[model samples]
Target chain A: MKKHNYSAGPCILPQEVFEEASKSILNFNESGLSILEISHRSKDFVAVMEEARALVLELLNLEGKGYQALFLQGGASLEFLMVPYNLMKTNGKAAYLDTGTWASGAIKEAKAFGETVIVASSKDANYNYIPKDYSIPTDADYFHCTSNNTIFGTQMKSFPNTTIPVVCDMSSDIFSRSLDFSKFDLIYAGAQKNMGPAGTTLVVVKEEILGKTGRAIPNILNYEQHIAKESMYNTPAVFAVYTSLLTLKWLKKLGGISAIEKINEAKANLLYTEIDRNPLFKGTVLKEDRSAMNATFLLENQDHQELFDSMWKKAGISGINGHRSVGGYRASMYNALPLDSVQVLVDVMKELEKNS
Target chain B: MKKHNYSAGPCILPQEVFEEASKSILNFNESGLSILEISHRSKDFVAVMEEARALVLELLNLEGKGYQALFLQGGASLEFLMVPYNLMKTNGKAAYLDTGTWASGAIKEAKAFGETVIVASSKDANYNYIPKDYSIPTDADYFHCTSNNTIFGTQMKSFPNTTIPVVCDMSSDIFSRSLDFSKFDLIYAGAQKNMGPAGTTLVVVKEEILGKTGRAIPNILNYEQHIAKESMYNTPAVFAVYTSLLTLKWLKKLGGISAIEKINEAKANLLYTEIDRNPLFKGTVLKEDRSAMNATFLLENQDHQELFDSMWKKAGISGINGHRSVGGYRASMYNALPLDSVQVLVDVMKELEKNS
Candidate 1:
């Protein structure tokens, strides 16, 4: 069966990246060594770390302000704690925008460290839209926001222009679009989304924002430790990093984030248009704040849910089910997801509408 | 050139394991989805996590016990902090043996949480061998030790026979030999060495030892939270876990750890015998306490260091340099390092001797 993947994370990747990454895992660049076998500190592997970091900066367009890119272990979950542990020390209060489940998780971890003031919350409306018109606390140490809500299929289309530093968890929508990164002091995301796999976390932090926390953060959790050691503080996930570099390389060859954003926008627009035009389906998230990364919808007649599910499965479409927490259908169209895959889903939706 | 990989961690894996792992990275289980592109919450992925967990216990012969194996994102570095956060609230000091770098790291993190005692330390002699006649403090909550010292090339031939809880970091030499796991309350290892890769950490813990900590641990760092959720507490390193399972499956097919132990013993013996018999090279660690995983050696003439290095590199051997802290050569004969590679290194030693 020909499958079109719409998984939220551990999501789609370029074919060249997959081939290049797989070859390295087998025999790294013909070094007669598997990327899985080499020490992360070795010259070859160190070069990989360097290139991966360099490409990340190139993708972000923030090259010269001494921003450190760390490829650390522990997914974004650990970063939720570490970010607050390191950045939430001064004034003991940080402003957080409660966007969805992941944002709530970050807020919970930050609260454990100190004070967390939710500047804005979308929970009142079941997180169908991004919250608006919230005042940022001037006394807060930093403001935290989840750039894109994976479950609710909502995104902060434009970041809040605030005086306090902005720390964004861009786990799902990172690298899918270009943004003015100068607006963020810290940006973190798990690689499962648009990067490579699920082992590593990408942390882009302004060098000046760290070292303020008086708390003795464990070495592994401290971004400063990884930054000082060039992400080689301990053995890194060599294969994941290698594959990530390949993905980054693929992104670079495809004209970087600018080119990807256009493709991503096109893909998302195609699917969402199909949802709005089709009577059988109803899009879940607010049209104004609809996510350009994850397109979620539901069958209007719930009785046909199982039938629609079976149709998609037999059509070789996978991971289109919405999060169990949300419970309809979610089609995550990440950077590597081709337009053809989205078109396939749109075709399936149209066919379902015609039969009905 | 044929390379002999001796990178202590992120070490060698069987060629077959790499082949199988690489296939999944491109197209997993013929699902036409890159393993990197699948949702961890998907049924296919949940089964991978379940099988990987099962395989770890099966390899350790820990089935039917009250033990649970978790595949976590943070490497053993995070375990240093998590061990204390999960089990240190007994209102008593945790007893730790200072075997080497990693053991001391655990002790440092434990001190941050509660009272911790350094029961014994091999550091007095530069951790060249395991300490003997260590007393487990009477009121200690747990006795922690590092099972194998990757840097110092030492091993604990036998564990302390005590009624108190025993926690061990077996990152360097796990599955290299049969272990009496009955004595261990918890055992964790970073999967860079003899296991699989570097991103995931394997933890086998007795379920009853947790939830005693009164202090609130950050959710991501809590073992009890992970156990209750069956290691899917968050998005895990799915690819690393799958690869580790492939390695475990390969281990089982080769007749489990016992069969591998004999092969490991022969590989270590072959290298150590050459180091002992040859006048050009001298083994670093004590003969009795020599590690079966990494065998360290130093040349008699310091000037010949480059000569030895070039010889090995020309023969396609990489990562043979000893750690900078200890200047010499370390040939890490991990589980996947065939005895033929060891013989090749021995042959290099003999060739060096003939010229000298």
Candidate 2:
């Protein structure tokens, strides 16, 4: 059976990327040595690191924009700590927009360093919408926000025009849509969704924004040190970085973000259209704030939950069960999810409605 | 031709592990979804994480000792910061043994937290031998040391007896040899070496040693939080953890640490014996302190460098070039490296001598 993996993260990547990555594990680059066994500093692997970093900038169209792309380990959670350590100064303040769990988590870490302020929060309504009417304090070291909340199915369509350096956690929705990436001082995403697999995190930071914090930041957490070392300060996640390079290559060959954006929109629209139109189901979040990457929806009658679950499982759809916080279903339509899979999901929903 | 990979950390894993891991990337556990696409929360992957953690304890004989095994990211370098964050108390001090590059790196991070005392250092002699006659400060929060120095090819034969919590970075040596295992309160190793690949790190810490530090550790860096969360504090390196599990299963099937320890010793002895007897080459580090995992050696005549280098390359040998800091050849024979490969490398050394 063909499985349509809608996993939130460590999610679906391009099939070609998987094939290449799988082959590399056995014999990387025909070097007769598995990618798993090669040194991160080897010329071949170094090319992978360099290409991955370069392609990130190229895909984001941030070439020559004073941004350094680093493929680091520890996922975006570590970035939560690093962002404050590198950006927040001594006794400094940071403004964060609380949209969902990850945003609150980031704010939690920033509080350990200095004063952390929540500019606005949609938590009152279970984070069903992106809070747009938030003001960033100009004095705050940086205004941080989660571009897309994977759990709540909310995405900030337009970022606030901020003078204080802007940092965005694009963990789930990065590279799925076109954005003016240069507007943010730093953007980080775990490579599980839309990028690659779960071992690495992509950190694209503007060089000028660093080194101003004056905090005694640990070398491992310091962005400038990682940049100076060309992301080789320590042994990087070699397999993860190489697999990300393969993914980035897949994205580039598939016409970059602009091309994937249309496909993603189509996939999200197909499933969301079925949810909103079918009398048996409804969309979970506000229409405007609904994430194009993850579409959360619920059956209109809780009684039909068993039937709906069985139908999707029979249809070979996996990972559609919504996060426990938000009950129902979440169809994560990342870049690699084909429109055909979404159509299959929509067909299942229609079948459920007919059965009801 | 089969290649002999000795790339140092991020080095060799078993061929069976490579095959299994490669297959999982395409379709995990006969499930139509790639392991790369599966959720960490999924029963299958959760099992991987659980088994990997348990196997670490089981293999190390630490299971009944109240130690929690965690698979983390950012490598041992990040653990350099995390160890102090979770162990060193506010305004407390730490005692360290400066063995080689990684030990010094750990010491550097420890200094950022509080007072760090170096009880002994082998740096006066280019880290050719482990410093044994040193007193660890009883007042220190913990005593730290590197079990093996990958770059300098030195290994600690004995650890200092101390009442303070003993922490060891066994990145290059863990699982390759059998130790008392209970002597150290905390042991961390980057998975790239004998474990699996370059992405996740294995941290086995005694539960009693945590949370005593009055310092407010960020949740991500907090070992207790990770332990509480069952090592899935956030999205783990799903693929890395899974691959490490595959490697662990391989180790277990092959008789775990005690069994592999014998094989590792044999491989190390084969190469070291050749380096000793061959007139053309000499070992770099002191004989008493030579590492079984990584053997460093130099040509007796530097003029034969080009010839020896070519001979190894032609014989399908790779990653033997020594680190720049230590300008000699380093052959890292981690647990997965078979005795046959060591014989091949030894054969190359003899060939070089014949040519000389």
Candidate 3:
């Protein structure tokens, strides 16, 4: 049985992407070299890096618009520090929205580099919904927010238009849907979720916005340095980046982000409908703000927990167990997740409802 | 004929390791999930992280020691900055030996956080030899040096026993041979060489040595934070670390570092002897300081360069080309490189000599 993988990041990648990547691991580009053992500086892997960067630009429709793409390391956690180190200047204040754990983590790192203000938050509501109607400070250097909260299963339906530069942590829902890519000055997504594997972080930065921060940014942490080197400032995560290129290739074939958005919406709708309609289940988070990437839900009747668990297990479903903080289920409908798997999950939920 | 991989890092791994790792990418632990897509927090991957950490200790004979092992990202490049940020106290000086390009790069980052002194340097001679007779300052926060200059093919003959904490960038020659595990307070190696791949960096630090530096280290760059989180202070380089575990398992099955050291020595001796004896070739670095890992050589007569290049190419050898800085050939004989492969290169050298 083809199991539904919903364990969040490092989560589901396209099957063909996995197959192609596995073949490359055996012999990359017929070089008789495993991708895992090839230098990041080699011509073969260099092509992979170039293509990955170009595709990121194409997918975002930012090519020639002066947005540079960088595949970096240390994941989003590292980017939390890097975002501020590169953009936040001396005495420069950046506004951040504290939506969930990840946003809070980013805010914490930003505070170390310079002054950071939490302009708004949903913490009082336990981060069950994305906070909106927060005014951006025009004097702030940038506004930082997470597009999707993986743990909370809440997502910003639309980005706020503002005069100040905007930096986003789009780790969980980056390529799953289409967005106005030009609205933000900087965006970083850890590749574990919708991007690729777990090692590389995709950083898209406006080329002109750098170097104004005044602080001597560490070469590795600086966006401008990474852009100048074309993301090869150091030995990059070769396998991760190569696999990302493959996944991006898959994404393009699936008609890019626009097409994936429809598929993602369908999956999310199917699952959410089941949870809302079924007497035994209830969807967490506000319906308007529920993520198309991660859909969190719970059993209305806690007594039916064993039945729900066994049903999903029997249906060859995996990774539907929600985050420990949420304590229910989260059927992540990432781009690669087919509607068939969502149907299987919905049927299981409906069966539990009928029996219970 | 099978090609001999000497491409430096992500250089070569045991062929079986590649095969097994490729299989896992198809289906990890029979979980019907690709290793690339598996959740890092899952039990299977958690086991991999723990095992990789344990194996680092076991291979170093540091089991039950105060030293903690971390598989991190940003490679050794990030560690260059991280080392200083966490350990270099305010206005306190640390000593460094400028050995080669990488060592020089490390020096650049060290200067960012605190005072750094270059105690000795081999840069006077294009870094063809490791600097010696260096005196350490008793009051220095740490004495730092690169144990091996990969591009120049120079290896440190011995570490100076010093009272101040000794930090070393052992990126190239970390596991090729065994050493006294207690010598350095902190040692970081990029995994592309002997360990595994390019994304994850291996950090070995003594627990007692941290927090004495008296700096407010950022959570991500702080060695103590990484220790507290078991290197999960962030979402780690998952595939890189898992692949590293497989390589470590292979290393352990082959009797750990002691067993691999003999193989490494044999490979280096075979290649270096040819480089020294062949009329068409000459070893680049000082013989005593030559690395068992990367053996750099040049054509004695530039007129015979084509013949030497063609001979190696015909013998199914790859990645033996030296770095662009000092170009001729750099046959990086990492631990996974077999004696047979080195012999092929040796034969190629001898063939070039006869042809010339």
Give me the candidate number with maximum lDDT: 2
lDDT of each: 0.87, 0.91, 0.89
Write one digit per residue (lDDT tens) for candidate 2, span B205-227.
99999999889999999999999
Query: What would the per-residue lDDT of candidate 3 be over residues A1-356, giving only the tens digit for each residue?
Result: 88888778888898998898888888989888889888888888889899999999999999999899999999899989998888888889999999999999999888887778898999998899988888988888899999999998999999888898999999999988878889988999999888898999999999888899889988778888887888999999998998899899888987999999998888888888877888788888999999989989888878999988998998889898989888899888888878999999888887887887
Model 1, position B285: C-alpha lDDT score: 87
Span of 10 residues, lowest total lDDT, candidate 2 chain A: A267-276
Structural similarity of chain A in candidate 1, as TM-score: 0.98
The TM-score values for the models, in the order shown, are 0.98, 0.99, 0.99
lDDT of 3 by residue, B1-356 (tens): 69898897888898898898899889999989999888888899889999999999999999887999999999999999998898888888889989999988989988887778999988888899887787889999999899988899999978888899999999998887989978888999999988898899999999888897777787888888888898888888888899899899898999999999999889888888787788778888988999998888888789987777777888898898899877888989888988999888888777776766
Candidate 1 C-alpha error for residue B346, in Å = 1.3
Candidate 1 CAPRI assessment class: medium
| For model 2 chain B, the run of ten residues with the poorest summed lDDT | B2-11
lDDT at position B189, candidate 3: 97
lDDT of 1 by residue, A128-170 (tens): 9998899999989899999999999998899988898889999
Q: Is candidate 1 or 3 superior in DockQ?
A: 3
List model 3's recovered fraction of native interface contacts, to 2 decimals. Answer: 0.83
RMSD values, in order shown: 1.5, 1.0, 1.0
Compare candidates 2 and 3 on lDDT and give the better one.
2
Off by over 4 Å in 1: none
